[model samples]
Target: MTTASGGWTVIQHRYDGSVGFYRNLSEYTDGFGNVGTEFWLGLSYIKEIADKGNTTIRMEVSAADGSSAYEEWPEFRLGDAPTYTLHVGGRGIGTAGDSVRYFEQGNNGSDFTATGSYCGDIQHGAWWHNSYCTYINLNGEYATPGTRSRYDNGWGGMVYFSFKDKSSLKMSTIMIRRND
Candidate 1:
């Protein structure tokens, strides 16, 4: 069977000298009836291995359709390397057929306009953008930017940053609507 959009696999390491594995293969419907999938894989060293207390574990992953971006928030510390790489080459699709279009205003405080921002494709993935909105350009368009958007695909994933005249600005975002 084909994996769902958000299927996941998980592996666990218990106190015993054995390992456990689990996979979440089916999609789920939220309160709004929208369907989504999720999968994860984790490993645990046997009690003998963890007792050492200084061993480090390494991990590698390959995924698409925003699967690779899902992760738990790591604690804030020095020298953290949370990285993501996407291998996509083509003009992504939009809600209105193959055209790209979207509008954004109040970006960076200055009034600017951009085109080619309507990208909501599922196969080619969608645009994902996170910016330091200084001037707040209320009108901007992103064309094949490869950065996910909240307007499409319910939650095309994204990371954002903001500042308020030197002081830290707390960013606020809403989740995608759950429905067909």
Candidate 2:
């Protein structure tokens, strides 16, 4: 499933992590002139091992031209029930560089609580160009250059999930969404 808004698109995917250490759940293309993109994911029916603190999950995004960025979450205990919701995305709100945030929520009885939150600048990575806006000639069509628009370089990207101890986990749901 997929949804779009103001030039950004999000797709949902289903994944089963019964036998691997890493799983690439979904991938997306942000066209050719988007400022930033966001992804939200949910995992259910989790089966964790006795040593849960070593298990990990990750989300990665890359430009169609090869530029990329990624963020990973910390380990959890077996008794935590394993279900989780994660959010990863970039925002063009700061002057230094594009601001990025990664957040995680773990299931607890009838509710979920924030487990992790991280912030960074997209310019720190070599995959992305520091210029917030740039002109591009697309199939003979000309586009204006500048950050006046929120999305200027709608590059392609992907989302992935990884586990440290594969034998202990069996995920049932891999709900994913993209937001601008």
Candidate 3:
């Protein structure tokens, strides 16, 4: 792995799409021969509804950045719907209007950062309800149906929700590409 001067480390290896960890990149294992530290495509989990029109997928991760923390979740796959508990914690935690945005991946492995909208506080579980879902906009803003929602409490940053109840709807169909 080569670290860029800006701090983004680029890891080079084959990603078999199995299960493993990477530095500053998505977790993946290219094959069995290359173990940890080598470039390998570990696993790629994806969910899609066969007979549905709107494809909305919700993924549960370690709440940490980079691929290493992502590998912490066992049996990870794409499209497999799972309920999650949302919390906020980070350097960008508290401040008026600051928040963490959630986004779905595109076909190319890019974050599509511009498309992400703010869902809740980036620091931890600050803005959320037991059974509430919010929509996002291109500017990373959280909103209800039509109007704009405000994160007034600078102390709370914002609110976010997760799969608190197991009985909720099936999140999405996951397609596990590879498992190392």
Candidate 4:
């Protein structure tokens, strides 16, 4: 779903443990002849609702498989607001060597900056690996990923958001399009 402003495409997912969703960009063959998506945008939100002691929300991404390229953003308690916004985009879509960026903000007056520049890997499948946000739970243990699972595979040219925890989360908006 998309917000009224049409700036962002909203997505909501409740997490019982480690979970993720992704949007594929394109298809390409890796240097080793492994065929997979050339570029992908994976968004994962980690939070424990019941445990107020754990007040950190982590957002992470997996891109350029086998290149050890990844991005993560963590936000602390901003306020009591339950809504959050994640803005992701790049200069060009389907363009080789284009850079991708991510930003986030919470209703509690918390803001997160975009991570460093990351380019899609054409040689290796830019698949979503086991990338997750940092979870800091003081009272309970956080979830973790055991293997690589494509939650939203074949969803290219789109945006996806996954939420994992006891509480239900809502996405107000999601914007995916050309920046210029």
lDDT by residue for model 4 (41-109), tens: 222221122123322222222222221111222223222213222222222122111133212221123
What's model 3's lDDT at 139? 17
Top-TM-score candidate index: 2
Model 3 regions more than 4 Å off? 1-45, 48-71, 78-130, 133-177
Where model 2 places Cα greater than 4 Å from the true spot, the runs are: 1-51, 76-100, 104-180
Better by TM-score, candidate 4 or 3: 4
User: Using Cα atoms with residue i matched to residue i, what is each candidate's TM-score against the true structure?
Assistant: 0.17, 0.24, 0.18, 0.21
User: Cα lDDT of all candidates, in order?
Assistant: 0.19, 0.21, 0.21, 0.21
- Cα lDDT of model 3 overall? 0.21
Candidate 3, run of 10 with poorest lDDT: 165-174
* Candidate 1 RMSD to the real structure: 19.3
Displacement of residue 85 (Cα, Å) in model 3 is 14
Question: Model 2 Cα RMSD, Å?
Answer: 18.0
Please give the TM-score that candidate 4 achieves against the real structure. Answer: 0.21
lDDT of 3 by residue, 25-72 (tens): 122211122435333222221222211222222221211112111111
Instruction: Please give, for residues 25-77, the per-residue lDDT of candidate 1 as tens digits.
Output: 11100011111212112112111232333222211111222222111111101
